[model samples]
Target: MNQPLPQRNEPFRPGETALLLVDMQRIWLEPGADPSHPERGPDHYFYRHTAAETIPNQERLLKAARANGVEVLHTIIQSLTEDGRDRSLDHKLTPIHIPPSQPEGLPVTSLAPAGDEIMLPKTSSGVFNSTNIDYVLKNLGIRYLIVVGIMTDQCVDMAVRDAADRGYLVTCVSDACASATQERHDTALNAFGGYCWVADTDTVIARIEALGKSA
Candidate 1:
């Protein structure tokens, strides 16, 4: 018999798994994007490194997901109204928050969802709070989530903790997510490691490949 996955094996069912890509909007991933311009300035090193490291890793993870027939879900952060009426409390407190881009935010080109893939639109850092993602996952009988995307210290971090609390087994692809700074990225993973297994793209890909359908 195949061994249970390294940790928290019972609930991490492959057939019940979904690969969640969080906040990969162009506003956060693209270098010259209007929302990211301030953070992508000539002197901004964090974004420079993020675009370099995170995007590629996310692309690799995406490829593996598609090839393996894994369910791919996307969560993009955006305010639902121009007047910011729907914005979350933490969003309002942010000093220079980016408003949601029109007709949904622009996702990075490489990460754009195919027409049929599920896209979870959200106004809060926690994907489950502002979106029907949890409901969808539950309906699909999903019990495990392989999470990846931008701003690891913020959206990705919150989503990970939220999913854990909601009783979903989660594996965070560390390299496939980014943050405002390396330190923040590391800090988030450190704190959340207790709630979820932290793995890189290679490890995640291998696990996905090895997963079996629950009968």
Candidate 2:
């Protein structure tokens, strides 16, 4: 059996951990010309504010993770094909309009991974459910994950639960994540506090910088 994860402080063994960027793709981050889900509406005020707070933090966080030798991984939602068959009810019916359907080249709004950084294109909220991310993480000896992304209430929450269950120490960077609205964001963060330790981007960044300096 695999070994258990470390307590918060005891983890972070150089190359043995990673920073995961979840669903920061343009379709999710920026409002499209045509709203995908008419019900959800073209990204509202809450989304704009959330993005304002999250995007910068993630950009800084990713920078620190890279300089410190922590593996940087990104996840983007993309359909395997244009056929609506592979998508869920919401995705099938709601058409995406921004850069429409295809995943755009990153470095979007100060957040983009280096060519060496791995990009896991997924179709589900739980990154593990749709990709070989778990296998890749395990191969890299990554027993802990620092997660930062868009929509803290949905994709981030689902990924955290899955990661913890799979025996990886999960750290949810609160400020580096956002929801469509503050209410939803706070709800998910506070509700799942027990499942994972939620942290701030500044604190995480300092820790990474300090550790990198010492090493």
Best by lDDT: 1
What lDDT score goes with residue 153 in model 2? 81
List CA RMSD, all candidates. Answer: 3.8, 3.4
Clashes per model (N, Cα, C within 3 A) = 1, 0
Candidate 1 deviant stretches above 4 angstroms = 1-6, 9-12, 34-39, 95-104, 212-215
TM-score of each: 0.85, 0.85
List model 1 lDDT by residue over 1-215, tens digit each.
99854454333555688899998876665555645355467447656776677888878878877776678899887777766777788777773344555633657788889769898777788898989888999988888898988677888988899999998888998988887778888998998898888888888877776664332
Give every collision pair in model 2: none
- Local lDDT at 3 for model 2: 100
List runs of model 2 lying over 4 Å from the truth. Answer: 1-5, 9-11, 37-43, 88-90, 93-109
* Residue-by-residue lDDT tens digits, candidate 2, 1-215: 99974576454667677999987876555555224434544458655674577888888898888889889999877666655456555554554322225555243656777868898766667888878999999999998799988668888998898998998888999988888778888999998777787889888887777768778
lDDT of 2: 0.76
Model 2 worst lDDT run, 10 consecutive residues: 96-105
In model 1, the number of clashes is: 1
